[model samples]
Target chain A: MNRRRHTIPTLALKELRDGIRNRWIAATIILLGTLALVLSFLGSAPSGELKVAALEVSVVSLTSLSMYLIPLIALMLAFDALVGEFENGTMLLLLTYPVRRWQIIAGKFVGHSTIMLLAILIGYGTTMAVLIFTNDGDTSGWQAYLAMMASSLLLGCAFLTVGYLISSLVRERSVATGLAVATWLLLVVFYDLGLLSALMLDEGKYISEGLFTTLMLANPADAYRLFNFTGITEVANLVGASEIKVGLAAPLLSMLLWIVVPFLLAVIRFQKREV
Target chain B: MNSTPTIELKAVSKRYDKLTVVDGIDLQINKGESFVLVGHNGAGKTTIMKLMLGLTQASSGQVLVMGENPANKSFSARRGMLGYLPESVSFYHHMTGLELLNYYASLKGVAKTEVSSCLEQVNLSASAGKRVNTYSKGMRQRLGLAQAILGKPELLFLDEPTTGLDPSLRRDFYQIISDLRAAGATVVISSHSLSEIETQADRIALIRSGKLVACGSLDALSEQAGLPVHTRLAVATGHTGRVAAQLEPHFEIQKITDHSVDLVCPVNKKISLLRQVADLGEVVLDINMNAPRLNEIYLHFMNGEKA
Candidate 1:
């Protein structure tokens, strides 16, 4: 009983230490920070023209950027979480330890999420800090900006969970890599592209407003988008998003579901998986 | 009453789809016994180990390790009491040996102090601070042995542990196994090359094509195999002719010299033949008995099955 408590933390800490050693944390921070700073510097001009807070305009740009970057990084970080262990032959020894399969999933999630959290903090935090230092005393957009940053993390975790599911479903790392890239193309790129095509082709004929609303939330990246964009009307208008049919809780709840559902499925798949 | 076995597989069979990997294996590994499982590649030796570890579930029948069903989803406290070294052991390459052992120690609920002792036992203490990526194959194997011996586990599984080890390293590996056995740890080893470990096994199970074809101690299997045991006798100069005359009637003479005679007899016939030879004690200068090897017994079994 006493040993079980430390199992997840032990595993999580190992992954955290691995990330630090591999310089993944540093790479993620640098990538996110450089991109956020560049967007913040160039994004304020639209804020002046559109009469929106500079931070809010930057949130719009970051949310769009996150749709591509967060999921890609999340998938890359964890696509082989289980498969790599199997490939390396470490999974056999890991299973011999006194740990349930779900704990493995939970521990990996916590560790990977920590890495993503750090990246978001140092990266997005830099932009928020610069905006505050240079701006008038209006702190109105900071709330949406924080929510966007948090939602970006939620988005990353959702993809991380999806990557775990991919890892659980396959035997080879090459297959996992291919499936992960396909997942990014589908969820981050093709999902929105398909939606746009559906909207263009449907033109309000076959797809209902509520159905369109649900479809947007069905994709986790868009759900994150709706969270950051819909809360601020000025940012929503700047991004040209149509009026959201659902309340704020809808996107948040959907994002939570995105994290929970795939994670549970991964655990189930992993439990039945033979080492 | 028989004590509960450390591991028991009752009619256990594992199949992946239409292919059966382990077929109705019924085995009992007693507490504190050193057991070896030997078979050719893809002969289901590793599958049996995996079944015992509950790394993969058996398709049919029951497996009990340390008196608990290892496949049970409820947390297994016994897992902390069990250790395994896979065929090709791998560690987190980024971690130092000390860190990796400490990680396992924490999971096994062992004191952190045991980590160093385990490293020392495997002769890895000098490089404990070095990352696994820098360690040589032999060093990594020793490190794996170090990990498997952690917590002084009640049960330890080593799969093909000496595949790439040097002879001296192999001797070191078995020395640790003997130490663990002295400390009452039940060790199960799966290997294709059982000849090297033949002397170390308390009992060995020979698996062929997913079925346990034969299992017993070397002598017992040799008996069951009906392989001949060789006996050599040095006779007094003039007694060799008398011995050959009497023993040739009951034994097959392998060789004959002026003062020495070598006789080969069936396992069952050996005792009686030896008794007859002992009657001529004064005439016989020395008597030597050589039992058949595990590999020969294996070949006999394989040939018999083939026939």
Candidate 2:
């Protein structure tokens, strides 16, 4: 029992070590940090002399960036996690160990999640520090920034789970990569466009406000956007969330669902997988 | 200490959709036995190993390891005492050898301090700090062996262990296997290198197309094959023809050269052949008797199966 308890952490630490050695963690940190820095600095520039809220504008732009970048990065990190090991023959060696199948999934989840969280923190945290030092935004703007960072992490987790599901479903890493990219395209880029077109074609008759709200919360990226942009008053006013009828809890709960359901499905798939 | 077999397969069969990989086969390997499984390509040697390791479930029948159904989730306890070296051993190329060993040790619930010693045992201590990608094929194989022997597992499964090793390294590898067996560990190795394993294996199992063709010690297999032992008589410079003429009527001459004549005698008839060669004492400069080798027995069985 004690041995099983240690297996997950041990495997997680090994994954982290491999990530560090492969420079994936460093690359993610640098990628996220550079992008966040550019968006924060450029977005705050116009509001400088106009006396507009610099932090609020920066939050909106960063939230938009997170919507596209975080999920992509998370998927890239995790799409190959399970299938790559199988391709490399490590999965056979790993399975021969005393660890359970769920432990493998859980350990990878913990490791990839840690890497994503670190990237988000260092990337956005540096921007937050700079903004706080440069301008005295209201406490509400700071709170919105914090909420955006948290939701970005959650968004990454949700996609990471999706990547694991793709990894477990496929036999080859190349197939997993293709499926992951398609998943990203479907969820982040095309889903909302398709939804908008459907709504436009409906002429406001069939697609009600409540259904729209549910549809928005259905996609994790949209859920993340609503939570970060609409959950905070300062950023919510800027993004015009007055028409969004759903309470704050719906998006949050849906985001949590996005993380849990896919992850559970991944665990189930991994459990029965032959490798 | 108990008399239970370390591994047992009862009518075990494995199939991949329409293709049957392992046919119905029953086997039992007892504690501390040094067993070797020999077969040609696509002979299901690896499938048997996977079945014993519980990496793949059997399509029907049962596979028991350490007296537990290895297919069950609860069989993880048996895995702690099991060590496996896959056919094409691979590792995280980014990790140093020591780091990889340490990770496996942690997974096996062994002490972290044993990592260095394990590396030393495989003669990889000098390269322990180097990343796996920097190591040669033999080094990577050594690292694989190091991981397999880390916890001094009670049951070790090695698939083609000497695949890429040089002759000396292969000798060193079998030396390690011998030492492990001496420590009362059950060692099961599968290899196509028949002559090499012939010396170290206490018992051998020959598989052909997922079926067990023959199983026993070397001498038992030789007896079962009914192969002949060869006798070569080296005569004085001009006596080769004379010796061949003298032996041709009573013995079958397999080959003849300027200086020698070779005769094949069944295992039971070796002594009579030797006595007859002794009668031609002065003409025969020297006489040598050679027993049937493992290669011949293996070929006999493989061809017998084909027939």
Candidate 3:
């Protein structure tokens, strides 16, 4: 067997193990799991021909909920990365070792990301399991449901990168926590409201389809929403969901771009950080 | 006096805006020599250590450990040579002592097979699996010490190594330091406790307000202070006045009391002076001879010289 022996994976495993042992992580996982279950059961809709089944609807809604929740968890995990060491005074001891600073950052990122991924898998996986068992392997929603699950993992990666960026930039854990919460509110909730208000005030003519596409491309949350509702919504399907006026790529590609840019920027900043 | 200088600072100076933390200190710590740096608060002792370890950048001059800059990103050779104990040894509270050691051991590239024995060395074998948060202050210090010696690092930097330790533990700590020195590990210890470090350090350096005020062996520094080694004489009768008058012209008499007299003179002249003082009068009580300690030398430079 060819094991790559990646530093990130090793660190991620270590972090996951540590998290599993911690009561905070266990409690958070339970809370998120309960939230996933409630969101799934409460949000499901009746099925129709060519429409996603109740289980798939539940899975999709749960995936959207995860888009917001996973990032918060990631930030909570990483905000104190450097600052915690400074408070605890362990950074000096670590810095004296032969390991490079980038490795430390990368390793920690991977570890926390793995934990987030595990949480998502466990939480959403349980929701899916309940849906499948309740419906008795109803086959209608499985494909689309799997796609949503995959997208949620990608979204978790995106949020994990953001958390690392916050950790790297801030010197105090308390400040980082506040900033992370504020950023979550802004990017996940208020950002969409702001975009919607802007579009409404500008009217349909001035905003244009290209401007709407470009705006959606700028924010990960919007891009994720666009991907989640791509051809599913009656209004979007009627407005010609297949057209790509903002270049040749679809909204999914725009979402992928959102994932790549911030991730790369975080890695760049992490590589240059001095312990 | 060893073959190699484990830590070499060439014209190194570290400044924070208008204030200099470490000022142009050119120092070399020889291999296998327990070098002690003694100074008070803001004396730049910690700054020098930070500069050597590349924790802080020097404003000017060069720092080389084993002929390489520790600041360079790719300078693994220099970094691998060092095992450092920070002033306040804080660790990951969530991790057990063994886990923390294993984590550090892996970072230092120490093979897993040797970790158990390394744990044993610090007397942490019994509680190695316990979380560090539960460990006492002395236990944490010992854990920190264990990590420092994990790979048998060729160079070690210990800042206040015995701060929270008990007396017996402190003795054990020095014994380990001495063994490290004997086994060819150069150790640099920075501390405010001159009494404890007096016997441990083969060479001592004094820093005052970011500048190297004095650097040498105890005997050499004592000579540099130029403060006379004190000799106290106690007389039975009223010869205190007469003896003071008799010896006043010949030597610089520091103090003359009713029953006793104290004088500062050369270490070489102590025997002859004692003989002369005894001959002049009936020496009823006792006489004590003492050399100037490092604390007095440090105070002399701190108060008398500009940093």
Candidate 4:
């Protein structure tokens, strides 16, 4: 058991080293940082010369940005994690080592999660730091900003875990990539549009308020948007939080479920795979 | 290194849907022996290797490595004692050869200091600092060999180890295999280059159409095939016809050229046939004997199977 524990760290270190050498870490940081900088600075321009705090306005835009960007980046980073290794023939060599199959998956998850966390910190963290330093904002505003950042990380983890599931379920990298893109489109784009259309067509008859909330929680992206936009009072007020029927804990728990359930399913599939 | 068998497959078979890749076959490789597996393409060679490595499960029968069922996850401990060089060796292209070796070394629980020496053993020391993508095919093969030998595994499986290697490098490869054998390591090699392994293999297994056609030592296989040695005697300028007539009654003449007559005789009758040829005096100018080679024995068995 102790030996198995050591294998995960070693494999994770190798994954990190590969990422660093290939400039993936640097690329991710630059992409996220530049976008966050653009969104934060431009987003605050609309609330200029108003009584509303600048940081609160930035948090609202950044939450929307995080809702779309974080999940996409997370999926891109991990969609090829398992199938790529198999296609490159490294999985066969790695499996021949003393490590167990679960260790391989766990190590990859740790490595990829760490990369995502680091990117979020440097990108969004830098924007928030600048905002906090430049303007004296209320304590609630800062607290809300921190919560948004944390939940954004959770949302990224959710998509990354889903990416792993796609990777383990497919035999080829191309198929995995296709599935990943389709998954992103479904959750990030079509799911919300489909839900809105259903609500509009129902006229509040069959799609009750309770069913609407359940449908929102069904998609991790929707849960993430609700958690960041409506969970906090300051940001929620800016994004019209009065209409939200579900509580904060439900969306948060669903996010946690998104991370665990897909991860467990991936492990089971990878364990039984012929490779 | 002991007398016990390092690997055993009993009535083992592997199938993919309707296609049976490895038919019911039994094989045992004892410790410290250099065993070679030779077969044509799609002859279940790689499938059998996968079975032994526990990369896949057998459809029926048993596969035991170091007295443990490799398919069971609990037997992963035995994997540490085994090394494999796949037919197509691939590495993280961005990593340097040294880094790749170090990565595998860590996975195998080997000392970091041993990485450099393993590179040296495969004649890859000069290119150790270069990234794997920059290396040539032969260089990559050497790096593959380096990684396989890194922990000095008790049992090593090399599939087409010498593919893409130059002649001298092939010699170097066999030299390493010999040294490993000297150190009492069981080595299993699967290759298409029969001449290279003919002198090195302690035992050989031939498979065809997903079945074991024959398995034995070189001499044993040759004897079982019962192929005869050919003797060619060069006759004097115009004595070819006369020599052919003289040898026709006593021996089976394989061919009669202008200057020589070829005769096929069993191993036991070789010496007497030579004497009979000498009695022809100046009719014979020079003599040459061609012993049966592994290629011939292999083809004989393969063709015999078809018949």
- Which regions in candidate 1 have their CA more than 4 angstroms from the true location? A1-5, A48-51, A136-138, A237-245, B269-274
Candidate 1 i-RMS: 1.8
State which docking tier applies to candidate 1: medium
Models, CA RMSD each: 2.1, 3.7, 4.7, 4.1
Indicate which candidate wins on lDDT: 1
Looking at model 1 chain B, report the run of 10 residues with the lowest lDDT sum.
B69-78
> What TM-score does model 1 achieve against the real structure?
0.95
B-chain TM-score, candidate 1: 0.96
Candidate 2 residue lDDT tens string, B240-298:
99889887887789999989899987777777877888888898989888888889999
Q: What is the lDDT of residue A221 in candidate 1?
A: 89
lDDT of 1 by residue, B1-307 (tens): 2998989999999999999999999999999998999887898999999889888899998999877778887635678878899999999898999999999898788889889999999999999999999999999999999999888888899999998899999998999899889998899998867678798899999998999999999989999988898889999998798889898888898888988999898998877987998888789989888889888988888678978
Judge candidate 4 at residue B54 and give its lDDT.
Answer: 92
lDDT of 4: 0.86
TM-score of chain A of each: 0.95, 0.94, 0.82, 0.94
Give me the displacement of residue B160 in model 3, in angstroms. Answer: 1.0
Question: For every candidate, what is the interface RMSD in angstroms?
Answer: 1.8, 1.9, 4.3, 2.4
Off by over 4 Å in 3: A1-10, A48-51, A231-275, B1-4, B231-289
- Highest-scoring model, DockQ: 1
B1-307: candidate 3 lDDT, tens digit per residue: 5566777999998878888888899999887888999888878888888887877777899998777777777774456668899888988888999988877776776766668887887788999999999999999999999999877888899998899999998998888888888888989999988888888888899898788889998878878877778877786667788777777776678898888888887755666777777778555377777888877877887787863
- Chain B superposition TM-score per model: 0.96, 0.87, 0.84, 0.87
Q: C-alpha displacement of A274 in model 4, angstroms?
A: 2.1
Cα lDDT, model 3, residue A231: 33
Ranking by TM-score: 1, 2, 4, 3
Models 1 onward score TM values of: 0.95, 0.90, 0.86, 0.89
